[model samples]
Target: MHKKAIYIMMLVAVLLASCSSPGRKALELSDNMLKTAPERALAILDSIENAGGLNREEQLHLVWNRAMAHQIMGMSLAEDEQLPEAIIHYREEADKQTDSYLLEASYLNWKGKRADAINVLNKGIGKIKDSTKRVKLMAEQARLLELQREYSKAAEVMERALELNPTKRDKAILNYKIGLNLSLAGDPRSEQFYSQSVRMATENGDTAMACEFLRNYADYLANNGKYRQSNNVYREISRMMPQMAGLSAIQMAMAGNYINLHMPDSARICNEKAIESEARLEAKGFDDISRRMVIELERCLLDYGDGKPVSYVGLSRYCDSITADMHAKESTLARRQEAKERLQWANHELRLDRQRMGWMLAAAVLLLLLGVAGGWIYYRNRLSRLAEAENSIDTLKRMLKETQTPAEETPEEKQQKSEDDAFFKKILLQQLGIIRMVASTPTNHNQALLKRIAGISEGKIQTDSLLVWPDLYLVIDRLYDNFHNRLTERYGNVLTEKEIQIACLLCAGFSTKEIGVVTQQSDATIYVRKTSIRKKTGAAEGQDIVSYINGIKAD
Candidate 1:
């Protein structure tokens, strides 16, 4: 028994020492020929695979080494511009390796395989340990997030990457990306990152990127209504990149800024300079199509300024239609390029193949139909109630308009305005008092009768705006001077009573909310009414209903 134990111990010791030896030898041979003849080294690796001398840990190391070899093979192929072959090798490397997702995602990005890159990054990013590798993966992930339009999430990821990039130039690049994502996310701190990025790029002697950053900085200032400061930055851009192409576009923007600042005279002069610059560009061999478009746009604005409404509207629609077509063509071209490149990508290519086009199309159509049906039902019911109230008010307003005439205001006109405003506030206060009296009135019949006698309507009081608001609508329409006529003209009778009420209140600088306080409607119900009002009034994208309402002129 003692002799047998000694023999087993000696056998185990030799096996343990030899566990990783054979794989190491194979790896060393592959590494030596990596710069010279890699295929021969790969063949040596194949030969040693079945020699069966490696333990589990050694097998892992072997995979790591093999992944490195495949990466080198891909790099050489890429150097020769053999992109498809290179991508295939990169996919092979990525499949065998577990450490780096950045390398895998880069090749996928090269092939425009964004979904495949997302999958690879999602799988590998969490397991990464090396700071550099983790940083690269985070940055790539942020780019993918941006493509998905998850701008805030992308900014967060870029912030993490920013922490890992210690070098000034690298951090500067990351900071620029952070600013881009934050700006798109509509965060207020986007300017801070933009400033940091510009400072760092200046320190790194990258004048080109710094100038680009300054251009955007100027745009931020201009968008926030700071025209003089924005012009200062624009002047800085000219000093930096004197020969920069497309500076004429900035002149067009400056013209817009002047228009917003209520300086149409200055706007006209700036627009002339823009048109001249664009004409110069056309003379210097630039395409006439772009310059012609700019000229047409300027002409449309000028027509509006010159009070040629009919011509301006027609030309504006023409310009919009042509611009839409151009964008559609550009989108189609982008899709074609993406599809072509996707065909060359081979990483986990079958993962997204489960759903067919027919299935996806059917599912999408079903969802769209259901959504349209639900939306139509909701809006139909909501609008019907609103239209009823407005119809009653509209009849009264037509009578008022027929009686009134356009004339210079007298002191009686001013007195009527004050008296009407007082009456409107008194009615609103009385409405609130009625609601509170009804709520706080005792359940006893005599007490409720007393409340009802006091003009509270008691237990029979209507709380729904659709049920009780028609009277209130007529009163508000009559009391608010010129609200009904002005709103009808602006939106062409599309404004419902609820929307008109909101608009009148907003014009009066009132924080309009639920009509329950004034006409017994629930806050949520009124909010839905406001949403429908916005859609019907054609509020511009990103504009809130209240802002649109407040912009309506009462006179």
Candidate 2:
């Protein structure tokens, strides 16, 4: 028996030593990798991989680390514009392991053969059973689909990914991707989907994703004439991604929506940002679509700044200059000319009125008399309605105040209430016993117990003032009874209510003032109560209140 026990102890020690060995090595490697040369890190990983007699887990870890190093190397090459070399390294890393198919897909996609990359991913998805891995692959596939302008298909892929992994982290990314696809699709139903995605992303703690979704959602809402919601979403996006290029231009486009919603000040701010973002985009050599968007945003800013309704002629000129679509630009210009001609014809008709002075003078005198009579009658009716409403509101207010007051109870009634309270306390204790039997387990029912106690206490005390007393012994008794019973059931013995309260107060590491606020007692009184409770409970010296509470169980 002694030899067997010694062998077991030795085995346990060996296992613990082995566990400690890898953790320290991993930490050391991680710390060195942060400051060490990349080539050196790669060499170390390569040595580990080639080291004979290593276990399968160790070999896999080495392979994973080397792959990460290669990926970082490829990214640096790409950033330096060495695409061919970057592609070679990325492809080599991807080809090293069958488990890392997503990396391979990314490499192929970036190499400009998107279809081939997606097919590779499809094969891997069929083989992988892990839902998390599958979800990640699907999201990557959706991103590729978005780049290809297959918006509907991309949305479908994102939805499938979300269905596979309903965790908040996954949901946030999925919703943002879906919103992006819908925004590109330009369908009215896209607005609804984008809004839902923005809300989900925000709830899931993905602020960056939420910001991206809100930006797209705002654009969709503005286009659909939901200006108020669109403007609000734009403001949120601006606040989140203040440094994002083209943000000001996007906000400028949204300014028109804000103005239409009767928010000129907000519109002006949006317009200013739009102009600034556009200037930044120009400096950065933005694409033709982005340039055209900036020009339109600038026109909008100018129109709003000048306090004029955006003129069709000015809009047409602006659109013609920047729009890439020849046919659309021509059509807009033609419409503007037609509108201008119509306005001139109306103005010309008004000019003819200058020759007919005698008839115009008589008509103006009669119109003035009619206006004066109508204004007087309208003002009198409005005043009468206002007076009636005021009187009705005053009567309702008085009735409400009367209903809020409590009825006064006599001395005999007070004595009867006192007798009733004692009877209810007995009934409450019996009910508590019933609850304990029903619960039959340690559970988080403290709030439920409090509710039951409050009901019982209310039955005893008829007056609100009595019920809300600072030193309500009945409430404390009920609270203690519930906690003590649960603790006893769990542990066979536990601290009394006063002891638990005192220990919790002390253990909470709170000041006397804080304890007073929590317990609704004065600081001096709380200190006194804590002292008495601690002495009765016999808590160990220097033990924390939280630790003591944690130890107790109502078994």
Candidate 3:
């Protein structure tokens, strides 16, 4: 048992030793330093002599660090373009995509193909799912945009990068860079960003960085005619002056602000302090001619502000020349930016046109499908109606053959028969027209006409008694050779008026459901009425009601 316990202890120690191995420690260190000091990271990564003992993850990590370090340092993995081969060696998809995009973009940028580099980064930003990798790519893109003098676009991209959840230090740095870009773009919002950056740096315990940020913010205020606010920021920087550099420059800027505020005495005091600081710097053998020139210019400004009468043509000419040079540079930058904006707008418009064409094509295809479906339905309905018409014609022929004979008739009877046939045909054609109109249009007028026809057939329109079915019974009697008259005469005592109407509709070749619609009754009621009629008329079971009515000639 003691030997077993000792073996367990040894195993535990071996695991701990492997977990904190020297190569793994160096990998972590190099990765941390990749953004801050790429050259140092590359040297540390190169010092790894033996990677054979490392695990697979450690090995992949080693390769990734080397590739990234070289890219950051603006060098290639191989002098002859073997960098892409190294990039694809990563197996994990997110890491592989990140390295491939960032490495390629960096390579292109180094080769003086900044536009292609931006395109590659944009593609990667769209395709990469990892937020960290997207942030890295955006940072590179922002760098390229800055190089192209597109300060507004650069600031916009940096704002997007901050939303990707970078580290606190990175967020502070991003705010500072965004402020710098906005200041270059001549946007007033840069003051807000600068203030935010200073606040964040102070909270992060970066005093030197905070003071540096305050210096720039003060300069921006002074340039924009906010001399009082600029003086306040300068005082804030003076609180941290021991940790800051360029005291002489700060004093000169304060003197300019005082001079702008028309406080000549305060301006003279600041100028004297600046001269003293400059002398001290010169004593340290770190002096420049520009510092003396700037100090003399401040003295001249103080003399002019004090209303000293002096010849000032040389100073005016020198100031004009400097202002003209600044304006020329600004105008050139504006034209270049305008051209770039036009190109970007053209590309955006082309993409929008492609999307619009796709939507139009989809809409056209959908319309065509609907049209085909509607045409098919219409054709089927027309064929059904034609078949119904042919069956109706056959029924008329069969009735004529069953009822007509070859015997001669008197002229009076023949004329009466011909008039009844013409009148009945006219009524039938009017009924068919009303039904067809209702089927096609279903307007209120057409529906009213259909109901009026139904009322006429049911003998319900009392105001026009001659139009009722019973009043027209003479014409129907002659048309059917008095067969319908005899059937009603025999069964009229037992049948209701509703039942008689249903019987008339049935003999006219209307189905039970159609009869119900004409009479405004349910189909079940129509079926019950038909059964009652069959019983009362003594018709045999399994015989059709219409055929039974036709067979009845006399009681």
Candidate 4:
């Protein structure tokens, strides 16, 4: 009875192996097309099509594989600039005996039948039960709409694609496409869409896409007369992709736009930056684009600043020609056709080889299953070993953690940290008070207060020793002198130097503790001086001490 059961099991396994379809073989052929080995791919696909005793599933797979081979060949021809010939092969594959709506849609889309492309995609979406495949079809349709310049419709379709479950990469692309459509539509809400795309790209860690978003945002800002903001955005672009050759040209263009907005200083700064970048590129022998950009920028600067108009006849013409030549040599499809064909052919051969090997893999898998069945008792032994290893790891980890010691903080260390924190807090409060005081005063008072604040913030202050109080006193005296000079310039004959110092202390809006820390004076003395200064400055009712000081301005 045991022998009979073994024989029956072996027979069932053999029958199942025989029933396996040629799908993997077809996939291998399809992969060859990607490697530009179209002839080899076609040969493998033809062998599959001619293989005898194939069931319906195997026949369908073979047809699909053959279609892929043709599609790859068409791509190769397109790369060779034989567009019409490529289209012919693409059409042939589209009409092949296959149920792959994706392949059909792709071919139709490339053939410029936009409506037919969308129709084929819709059919695929309806017929495909897999959520992943359905979303892919929707994305393709949305891309087609975008290419047709139907931006609103494209955005709506992309929204639907986003509704479907997508990988992070797909979501990023979807957001970018939506932003692009919104921008093309010229809607004010495009900024929000672009921002969303930027966030998505940043999350995905796609530096190139992030740079592109920054460039577009900068252009938008410049067009809207936000020159300073646009310059900031361009700076971000330069920081992100310093080696990008086009940035020099972009910076120069932005500088010219700044000049148009009457920001000559900013324009000069941008122009200088572009010239520096171009010089660096020239030094590295990557100066083709950079050199041209420098010339154009120099011309623009002269035109805007020195009354010399830019001439586009000689240098511009040459620059455009060079750009065209470089583009043709790079990622252009026409230059890569031969490689594409070879890849297709290799993929097709690999498919047939895999199909033959599939039976061997099945036999190995069956042997593995038998080993697993016989080793059930040994499985427990393996688990015991794993458990022992894990326990050992846990013991080592605990020991490591216990052996580690955190450094102890000294008294001076703790005190320094506290002082640093307090210093930053004081700075923050002082800044807020200055802004509020300046905003609340009259125009003349506002100018005087701004000048005083600028003086205080201009240079670094030295605080070397807490024991040497004279250094601290010197810093305070210097700050007071600056305040007095600015205040005297704006408000003449209103307050004496002593009163000005007292008024400045009041206008700072400091608490008693802060005032003592800043001025090296007692809180009671500060209060007494403030009262005396207020009386001397003005005797009006309902006037705050800070307001009274700001109220003194020369006509």
Candidate 5:
């Protein structure tokens, strides 16, 4: 039985090995497409992540390859005229990625954000321990500082990069950059560094790098009117790469130097040699488009220098191709801008949609609250009106019962009236106490109690006048029961809160001036309220509101 179980476990292990991990299939599919179709690979990777089948190792592979995909996307998408999105993707990829930082800094430098680009390089360098990468970052930072006109600081950075002991090829580039920086910093010794960089580039068989150093230094010399020295450097490059198509560039610069020095015959000879060298390089299978463009342009410049009519012949191919080159750069910039506008427009539309939804939601909430408030107000008013009507009917019945008696007053009626009056006053006191508590809050700034009381008095006249009038109505109903409904039913719905206050005070037999004092209203205000009540009751202008209110009967 034990041997059989061992055989069964071995079979299970073999089966497990035969099957793949959950995420492995998709990852393998993506890996196959990574080099040939990066965009499709990215989509596959994204789907795998969203569909959720990744193990721990698969997750790490996903992050590594996804970052690589984004880096490639930055290049291909930019070339495809999707630049803003491309740069954004590049920046996001660069954030945690050490290798991509240089690309991001280059973009920043092109944007004229030199300080920000340098800061990015500094942070990247701090994170990277690789000497080649550190040297590259430092050299770039030095170039940025030089562009900013901080020449000494630029030299300092370059000096630091040189201390990293880069390989021959990297040192050659860094040395050239440092020479440029030092030359611009007003150092005459920069020529030695330039010479060293050129010698090293030549020894390392990086003839192109050597040519770059020679060309830049020669151009600088020419610009400074050092024609003789610039001509020597050009001749040196011509000797180094005699059979290359690139010879046209050196001969052209040499011809320009000869022309500036008033050696027109020498310039003419160099121009002829440039035209001849072009045919040889073509025979040698040199297919550099930019170099050919420059060579043809120099051919044209040569004719102009020789005091001949500028030849339009043979310029069409290189001229139009160069024009396309110029347009390619311009279109790249325009596409970047177009991409930015598109993103901004999309974001703006999204924001507007969100704002519109928020306003709609707020309006919906407000309407719902208003509906609820309307129902509640109706319920409370209905209950109060009914209760006041029922109390008035009971009081009338009691009054009728007492009237039937000869002369004795009913104790129960007095007790009921007292209870009603007490209830009404209690509501008034409770409302006043709430007002006191609110007015006493820290929001009121804790002023003198007397001053606060005075402010409260003013508030009672302005706004709080309405709060008391409702309880006052209840008290009047308690005193005379159903008087409000009877008056309303007799008259129209013209009675307002102020009108009710006026009628109630008049029924209590208060003088107009005394009613004004009690209500915290001016005498003129009381008179106005009295007039309104009279109009509502349809009493004549000369009739007393108090007598009219007294004559109101429950029946």
Candidate 6:
């Protein structure tokens, strides 16, 4: 009887293995097309008659490909009904591979369906049994919450992930993520997690990751106004990665820390080293011209700090050039991203044509012709816009060069320029305060404050009866050769009234603190408003907002 039972079990095992082979092969074929031709990949996945024959891992792979296909095709999760089959398979093995759910949720979040993404992950977390898998889902959930700016809730989710006792590497990464969210949430306990992450990563022999964690720790310290400690961390990183490619970044950060610490000599030395390293990197084909401009600006700051003569026009040119480079890079990046999306959609349509060629040949031909026409029109419009932008940039650059230190200026011109420079300096100082505010606290209060600032800037709310926005506008127009009217005419539609107000403030010599006091709000509120202004203006990171605003030439 025992011999007969063994024979029967062996025969059943052979049958199960044979049945799974076709499903595995189908999965492999679909996987290859997931990236470039995901619509076809989905069709192949749909053709699989029995996913039940595949194991948990294979089932998860199928679902992952399916989810990715739906994402690439810009289809909602609800459109792909097969995505949930993997979750329904083998309830006992549910914890084995849950990454599909995470990927699906990520796609949903990217589509601005953040609430749906959270719900999907919550469902997965409830279904998952094992600690490791559950933590993976929870970690992703925490990440999504972070994007929603619910930093406190993100920290809580991360804490729950930690309670599950993840693997060593996972624990290290989780600790860093938790610290990041906690820090963003303005919780002091973030320091503990940051330290723990560094220690854990170092002990795990992941020195690179440890250094990365240490960098974040240093940034957090610097952000919280602990310059000395932040520099210490930077020094430690310097020791760890002495010959690293990113040495210039570390040195530049150290220079800023030293400046904050009121040590100009040390700051200058660090700045010089940063410039040297940057030059070396540039020689090695690093195309980040903006960083070099930033270093030059820092040098100007150092010179000014030492009571040396600093050419204001030269500084203005540098600011304008940096802002231009930033705008170009941003435009290129945006176009490239859109191009990729269009390519994916094109591939999706091609696959649909092939599948329906026999029945809808005439319709497919008509749609193809329309698509080509539309694409051509879009391409032409894009080129025209790009040409116009380039022309505008060229005109601005020519204006700056032409305006540079004319040989003989009238007394009125010199006084006006000097006043402009002074106002620019005031705006620069105010912007520094605004940047600091952005770094410190990013909360709901800041959001409300942004709206309030916008209201005041747009003239919806009057802070000063004597100098309402329109009155201030006229003052700016009279002072700067109708700069207010010209700026409005040029960027009136692109910039909100609030942004126009801030720009006027930049030109009018209003300090950030003065704005804050007048608005009856904190500097943090103004920071949020200033950040929005920067985005709308497309100003480069670390570039002078005042310079960018004032450098605009009416077309």
Estimate, for each residue in 1-555, the C-alpha lDDT of model 1 and write its tens digit: 244445544655564456447667887787687558766766666655333446654454445445445555654212223333333344435343333465456556556777887788876666665566667677778888898899999889878777775577778878888888887888889889989998999999999989888878878788777887877777777777887534577777677777777777877877787777776875696634564565557656776877875254544665686689789989999999898668535322442342245346556755665566666667876686565444433432232233233434559977665456545544543453533443566657445534343222221344342233456556656666445555667775676766666655454333333233344344576666667677888886556665565467632
- lDDT comparison, 2 vs 3, better candidate: 3
Q: Pick the candidate with the highest TM-score.
A: 6
What is candidate 1's CA lDDT for residue 244? Answer: 55
lDDT of 4 by residue, 212-286 (tens): 887787777676667778777777777888766345666686676777677767667767777676667667866
Poorest 10 consecutive residues by lDDT, candidate 4: 458-467
Off by over 4 Å in 6: 1-27, 30-66, 69-97, 283-297, 311-555
Scanning candidate 6 in windows of ten residues, the lowest lDDT window is 392-401
TM-score of 5: 0.42
- Lowest-scoring 10 consecutive residues by lDDT in candidate 2? 461-470
What TM-score would every model get versus the actual structure? 0.38, 0.37, 0.41, 0.41, 0.42, 0.47
The per-residue C-alpha lDDT of model 2 at residue 377 equals 62
Q: Candidate 2: misplaced stretches above 4 Å? A: 1-99, 206-208, 235-250, 256-269, 273-555
Candidate 2 overall lDDT versus native: 0.56
* lDDT by residue for model 3 (1-555), tens: 245445544664565447438789899999889989988998887665446567767776777778788776767644426455555565346536787887777877777888998999999899887777788889889999999999999999999999998887778888988998999899989988998999999999998888889989998899899999998898888887653334678888888899899898988988888888887887797665566567668888787777975455645665676579679989999998998789767756775685478557655655554565566667776686555434433443333332333324559877665555445535543444433443566555654654555444343543232326674456566666665677778888999888877776665555664555445455688878888988999887767986787776532
Better of 2 and 6 by lDDT: 6
Q: What is the C-alpha lDDT of each candidate?
A: 0.62, 0.56, 0.72, 0.59, 0.65, 0.72
Where does candidate 5 have its weakest 10-residue lDDT segment? 76-85
Please give the distance, in angstroms, between residue 223's alpha carbon in candidate 6 and its true position after superposition. 1.5
Compose the digit string of candidate 2's lDDT tens values, residues 1-555: 245445544664554335334433653484368335656677555433113334444444454555456655654211223333333343435343343576566656666789987887787767676787788778778878888989999998888887786677667667766766776777556666666777787777777878777777777777778887876776677677776534655666676786777666766776676766656765796634554555565566556667877755744664675555567778999999999789767655554453255346545644554565566667776786555434433432332233333434558866554344333333323333323422553447555544433333223322232223223344433533343333334433444554454443343234455344334345578766665554444546554434454456532
**Residue range 397-502, candidate 6, lDDT tens digits:** 2322333434345588776766674444333323323323334646655764344434443345555542356755766686677878877776788888767877
Error of 2 at 453 (Å): 99
TM-score, candidate number 2: 0.37
* Model 6, CA-based lDDT: 0.72
Model 1 scores a C-alpha lDDT of 0.62
